[model samples]
Target: MPSTSIESAAVDGRARTPRFIQRQLANLHKAITTNAKIIQDAIVADTGAKLREAQLEIHLSISVVKELYDNFSVEEALSQEYRVARGQDWCDRNDAVGTIYLRPQSHNLVYSIVSPLANAIAAGNCVVIESNKPHQALSSKIAEIILQHLDRDTIAFVENLPEPPSKGVLLIDQTGEIPKINASSVHTPGSSARVVALVDRSSDIVSAASSIVQARTAFGGNSVYAPDIVLVNEFAMKEFVQAAKIALSISIEETKGQDITASQATCKIAGIGLTEKELRGSGANVVMRGDLGTIAIVEDRGSSLLQRKIYGACLILHSVRSLDDGIDLANLQYGTVAPRNKTLLACYHFGAPEAAKYTTQFIDSYASFVNHAPIELTVGPAAPIGFHPSATHRYRPAMFSVPKADCIAGDSASRSLASIFRAEAKAWSDVYEKQITSSLAPTRQKAGKVVGFFDQGLITGFVVFWVPVIASAVVGSGYGIRAGIRMTRS
Candidate 1:
């Protein structure tokens, strides 16, 4: 286990005052503002994040914290907001969600620490964050600033990886610790824990192209979100292929010599299946050319992107003659299947006459939300645009991989991942059953009336942290329990 330590401000065991809470919130705002430069410096020094990227991540984190502060101040959480929306909306806007844990990894110090932590804090849950990465000094500085600003009860920025000994309501695991999340597999029967894995697809062609050109290629072709393959539709194949070729040139030109060399080297790797022409292109990793178009590896096969919640770029070119084909293709890709409102983006000449039918068919079929544009669907939470369907619910994050890994590479990745998930599910199920029995089992166990079931946060947290480390964990862990009258209502 990593070494753990606490910086205690209180000498006695007593809790602080409400006035203190207000003061702390204020101080937190100030600390983030004051340490802006320090934080930026620390992020760049600790990790290789460019000064600009560091600044944005830090800024966003601060903004999220501020949003949380505004919503969760003693007054706001107590005073309920209007109840226009029901369960989903209620959960979305409420602050009573369980505790949240934010653990950032070493390399991308700023993102790992800030993104999850800020989002958790914004959701009105008490937060405990771990800031021990490659840049311990920077992390420590950040922790110090956070601690100085927030109230002890609402937020705890800890130096320990084990956390503050307080069972997390939920954990935002920065480290890819899949086994810990899926605790029930090999040892037990069923799994109570659930996890949400976020993967930004490089298959989203428009966004991938934009990222390559606009976003300063911070991750090179190494981003998990970088397109593994451009699945072109039949209708858009010719144009998309031409555009893609051009885009590859632009990417190579922009990336200069960095990616093209990798692309060439990748072609030479045994069974990599890269074409000489593609090797001469900008895309790195394996580049396979086919009748439809090309599938660039973007990065090495099954790189770390598969493990982390990909929030970068993906460029996929899909040409479809019919709407059904589009949906089939989407599902074929094992797409995240998010609300159409949040899933698709319209780029370049996408909304034009040629692409318009494909776009309209998708929105109509999926019933997505469309603010503007012709062919667009929302994938995640950023925003919904274009002709999105009215029924904009049922959105989940998409997961994809790079290089057309044939039977060997593909099966290798899948089998290992599947085995890990299976083990984890079994372990968690046993623990969850035990908790239920203890909670409702006539004996007066301190576990209390089974108000509900499972730590919603913990379930999701486990998934986030443990899935990749052990994919089998996802297999047997879907079991859940319902609260009974024997349980006291909260």
Candidate 2:
């Protein structure tokens, strides 16, 4: 059996090469555009993803690449402007210090992985990648296209997520691996990198129910991202169930076309809510509605909310009595959210300003507001953009303490440390350490005997060399006395 260490192969001298890095990214951009026709044709041809979804990914990847390039270029211009405006203080963007690993969802390579990889490589990282699925003719074709442009070794694409050949975890002996993205394996980004996980909670209960109906009648409800669990606030359970029933009722009639099992084994964990119909279709037990929110999320109790990365539209609602509860939930579940992931946290009487502040604070992974402005702007919050990495969560970016280790704009350390330090310095002052302090005083005399010293109540001793005790005793305290005695005797 052969074993492969992907990062080891790509990393050289603890980092990646820049010249080749830029070239690969530039080529990737061209490849994505060049292969757009093939990508769309292949996805549609293969029936893996919806054509529009595939196309959207292509567009998004291109847009992101362009955005990253533009951002870097603008930063350069800004530096020049600053130099011109105020002599030589301006600074321009330079090559970054470490590698960025882009781990994308399986089956959707073009949008999720490739585009992000291009951006990461452009930022100057030697990249190593793994494909989510293996033996797909479409993936093979795309990989060939990508390989033509970039160095094969610089960008590795594992056929699928399997243990290293030597790890002894045989594929046949175990429960099969799911076709999903693994966030932990990507390089840590030089001890100062940020890692974000994206998830979309069950966004459409109506659609989920309808899909279940369709699947039961047409196919099966064994699809990824299907609403596996329904977490509603115990208070809102009735309202949520009513809303879901209404939504499903509308969907059922609209299609007049499907049979959804709303009862089977709706595994209702203590706090998780689900019915027999929902559980019949769920891969795991659903969390029931309870008197919990962000705070509950943080305290992983037996009957609390779930915090693992959830994709697809498995709706998990956490009921909260107050805004503070919601934010506490966000902090607890910070590990679960990512950019572009969507889910709803409801509050009945909250206003937008308070909504915005709280949502911004709750921001994790990618924070978004679906139906209404995050907090229900009608009575919720007005700020559209939800939570961002911040102090309450202890998220900050790297400070780039040294010139050589220039930090990326949104790296992990920056989000957890630098960001927190700058935003909540007063609150976190006691924990901050000063870089320099006065030296300690020596505690030994020239006589070689140990001398003692006191410093702020700390006593310390050290030994030092001196003349013999007999000689010192004879000569010490007698120089003047002996001289006087000699004079009197004369």
Candidate 3:
């Protein structure tokens, strides 16, 4: 286990403060930037991710740290003004959501964990992270790095997710296995997902196949965002499949450069929890590099591939009767057949933009890329989200914080952030002016229930008891407004 010194530090009163949170984040940033190469090498050695992929994880991790430091501020969070259209008659502020347990999905290791970790820190909450699966070792290294910079209480790591804290926890389970919603999920479940890539007759078969091939073969099918079952218009099936095979036919020597031994590639494919035979059993045609050079392509009808999250280098090409049929099938697969949003991503490559738009409406997915696949080859730690429906919240610092409303109800008040700030300055100035003058202080504004009256230097008010009125208004508003579209130009 990594040192729990930070956890030990948790008992200190200051550990929960915003300043300590900022210091922890700054130290984490320093560690990432200082030891980027060591972390990258560790990820590669542990995950079998290519050098570029591992490097991307490290690069992204550093960027997220920097982004969090620049954006999420403790002082800023406390003072956020939820300006009401009623023009300062009411307002809201943010309260720390409280200590959050960040459950990072281990599939992508650094990429998955770091994003939420940054947010949790920014929200000014101590976080306990739970890491698991193939990336457990990588998780430990991250904890080790974090420990060097952060005190134990500010951040801690556990082997498994515990009972939810009083404050909400970030359940970053990319596997779609989070029993209930936590903070977020970068990858939803694919156990029942079916990919539908529409390749019309007029579609660029070569481009479609190339992108899909790259997505499928890229990173050895670990990417949940990749297409599992491509829905090619029946008229273009043969051409698309042919193009796909050609795309995967890149030289064996080139594939060999990835440094995977033939022994691993030729494994009973059964051992990896997925095999071509099972996929073929569904009436799909198999195409791959000779002697199983890593890439595997299966051509089948849409019905043949459903609810199967295949691991390894395999792409499934399925035929659809028509674009409408494809859309309906895609819709049916994601809508009724699959639980939750089974399809994480759908890529449509077609000449008819209108018809493609119709397909996306029916296909239940987090994101759909028109004329493009969801495989991003950028140099950073990343996950496919924000564009699609996710079970988890956006990887933002705010999700870790609670918003407690500090409402000031009045008929009139400062109308803008600038005005309110100016008033606050004046209030402080008035206090100093009285102190220097050494005169009997003016009757301070006495604000209270039962119509209490008071006056300040520049302000006066009759404080009516607002308790019962507000209580009734809360219930009255429900019955007061009719449900309909109403647009107002404030």
lDDT winner: 3
Superposition error at 178 for model 3 (Å): 3.6
> Stretches of candidate 3 above 4 Å error?
1-21, 73-92, 165-170, 180-195, 250-256, 262-279, 290-304, 337-351, 376-394, 409-490
Model 1 lowest lDDT segment of ten: 394-403
Model 1, residue 390: C-alpha shift (Å): 17
Leading candidate by TM-score: 3
lDDT of each: 0.40, 0.38, 0.59
Q: What global local distance difference test value does model 3 have? A: 0.59
| RMSD to the hidden true structure, all candidates | 25.1, 23.3, 20.5
CA error at residue 73 for candidate 1, angstroms: 5.8
Q: Predictions ranked by TM-score, top down?
A: 3, 1, 2
Across residues 369-411, which tens digit of lDDT does each residue of candidate 2 receive? Answer: 3222211111101111222422111111121111332223444
- Candidate 1 wrongly placed segments (more than 4 Å): 1-22, 70-99, 105-108, 115-126, 132-138, 151-160, 163-168, 174-218, 221-227, 234-238, 241-323, 335-490
Model 2, position 452, has a per-residue lDDT of 48
lDDT of 3 by residue, 283-326 (tens): 65565545322333444334345546554566666677787777
For residues 289-361, what per-residue lDDT tens digits would candidate 1 score against the true structure? 4321233333322233222222222233334544455454443333334322222222222233434445445
Give, for candidate 3, the lowest lDDT window spanning 10 residues.
375-384
lDDT at residue 81 of model 3 (Cα atoms): 34
Prediction 1 global C-alpha lDDT: 0.40
